[model samples]
Target chain A: MTAHASPIGPGPTGPGPTAPPPAPPAVSPLRLVATLGISGALAGLLLVSVHRVTEPVIAAHKQRVLEDAVLEVLAGPTSYRTLYLVDGAFTPDLPAGADPRTLDTVYAGLGDDGARLDGFAIPASKPGFQDKVSLLFGWEPKDGTVRAIRVLESRETPGLGDRIEKDPAFAAGFVGRTTPLVGVKAGRGTGAPSEVDMITGATISSRTVIDAIDTTLARLRPALDAYAAEAAR
Target chain B: MKETTAREDLLRGIWRENPVLVQMLGLCPTLAVTNSVANSLAMGIATAFVLLGSSVLVASVKRLVPGEVRISAYVLIIATFVTVADMALEALAPGIHKALGAFIALIVVNCIILGRQEAFASKRPVGRAALDALGTGAGFVIALVLMGSVREVLGSGSFLGHPLFGAHYEPWVVMILPPGGFLTLGSILIALSWLRRRRAAAAGEARS
Candidate 1:
């Protein structure tokens, strides 16, 4: 195969008063292949080294952040346990042959007694105004109200759609609100049990948060109920 | 081309050829992550690390690379450094890493790093390349912080999460949104051009 000449070198010059530019040096195919191969190898080596060095630290950091989010959304529970959804049931153990990464897991925040359930911190995500909005919300099964919410990840439009995660009023509206919440115009909630005050300019993002929680709860509430009953027994 | 001194190489990117404001390179991260001061600072440092590392490596290996594959080689080198920076940021400062989000990984595609490698690092000596990287990195950081300060102060009524105004301050919400980035950058560019023109006129009058 003919070697592709470097574009950086001068192109073929037509005869002119100025002496024609010297012919570009021929690049050997082997050398070109070796250059790319060595670069690829070096890149692979560097990335591998960095990944090894940072893997544990990143994992620990993620775990810590997840724990903090769980606690914040669950309203400062003494501790929390990971419950995997298996066959429509919440079990503390991972299901056979199921990847933990792909499995749907919820955190059951425990009260001081270690056995009392404070609430369930359910993590959910849905496409928002700009990107997917991931959040964790504390669900009180007994009262059927959301306790609190923490936006774990979101790329909503800053200062506007991002108010879903930043605005205190928007978050406060979710606290103690009934399940399957309804999004209303900002400050137009009639103090109804299921009404949520959406950010004025971020209706899509606000609705996305509600939809994420409501859909997850709708799919998991039956299993959650079973799990709660099993725990009670 | 006139040969540049080390000091000139180190200082040019800060104002004369700034990667963000003056040259208008790397605007993706500039606009996306500059809504808050902390995020802007974190991204600037991360990008700086990648640029510096890639430039140094590219300069060192310039001879080894054939012209046919120079761009590919530079991209590989850049991607490596970007990955290293991304991993380091996630490990050392996960909160900032999270806030920066996909922008960290997206640094591999940032034109500033590659443009420097092709335009300066591949041709210059290692020391010169390093100086250029530092200058460009500093410029990028300065531009990001300037944008961040404006957006955060006006959009959120705070600076780095601290409220600059009293409780009554009403935030200009649009200032932190995407449009805010364009508006802020446009205003800064206009002001910079105006200042430059005024300085040029004064210099011309004195010379006359």
Candidate 2:
């Protein structure tokens, strides 16, 4: 009968060896450990490489957003010329044609001459009721004005204090206002033609915007003057 | 492990061998990136890429790894793939990358990667391990996208950048906050459980 069963496990009648004997329950501990360690090292290297590659693209995107804001604030047929830090030694590197007027706060995109493009304004941040509030303002040296204002960052309450951001009439009030903007009540005539209307419930936020402008001008005026003087020469 | 039947291997991640909703693994990335659709999608892609890459490499070298120090070995392999995803994000789309912040780096701790290595990849053939990783990763991506869409729509009135609702929507701003993240997840889990129970009852009726 050709034995009818293979011999290897528990002999012919007990259990068939042809069944593969459960493959001896191979544990293979050494193989598992080594594979894991080597695989981990490779993955680490891959993560580092990808992070390095994406950093610049992200920065430029923010710059683009800022540039869009700057255009709303600057005046005349002007274009962004260049920036020079009053304190930084790199001021010497200011481009030859750069008007050197703007570039107080950053995130503004640079124009052809390496100056901040005319359309974008400086982005500034300051402490507000709960957290930091950031704003963008157009710095138009032509009339020595801050053309417009927009809130870029805030963490105030949504319906209450956040009304500062919620109310467009409040933001629209700041447009075309000259430097050193004075803020006041919205109705009954208190502002210069360029004066901004205050947010009814969020006086603190309104004040923060006014102060950021004050602070920006405190530092930005000198830089603007230098550029204006050069433009005249 | 014995070479799994094709159907069984594919079904593992759904329930009996789930990496997240069932096993409660990978909670850190799960919570941190579920705030918005963009964030969740980015995280899901990075993880899937890492899982796929590492699983294949581990399975290919299964015979070479020593048994004594496998855990350390597995971590090193996973970290390498994560680095690749990070650099790509940093270089190509830095805004999204910056928005995601440290959570991308934290993908290294995600239990999904290590679990696959220990439970399936180490024992399986290279091809099987890679496919298994892909399936599990796709499942994870689906979960993240679902979670992020709910949060973004409820939290911001925006779904993948479109105004899904009109201006009157209140946008439950809390949906974007940390507490909202926890609350949304709890509700999602409850909904998932109700679905499972209904499905089970239907199946039992059919059997009877």
| DockQ of the candidate models in sequence | 0.29, 0.33
> lDDT score, residue B63, model 2?
64
Chain A agreement with the truth for model 1, given as TM-score: 0.79
- DockQ winner among the candidates? 2
After superposition, candidate 2 runs with Cα above 4 Å error: A1-120, A128-131, A141-144, A149-171, A182-189, A199-207, A219-233, B1-3, B64-73, B90-99, B165-167, B194-208
Give the best candidate by TM-score.
Answer: 1
Query: What DockQ would candidate 1 receive versus the native complex?
Result: 0.29
RMSD of 1: 5.9
Q: Write the per-residue lDDT of candidate 1 for residues A76-160, one digit (tens) a residue.
A: 6869999999878888998678899888999998989898877999999999988899999999988789999988778787667
- For A157-207, candidate 2 gives per-residue lDDT tens digits of 665566666777776777777768777766745546656677777778888
Lowest lDDT block of 10, candidate 2 chain A? A8-17
lDDT of 2 at B158: 90
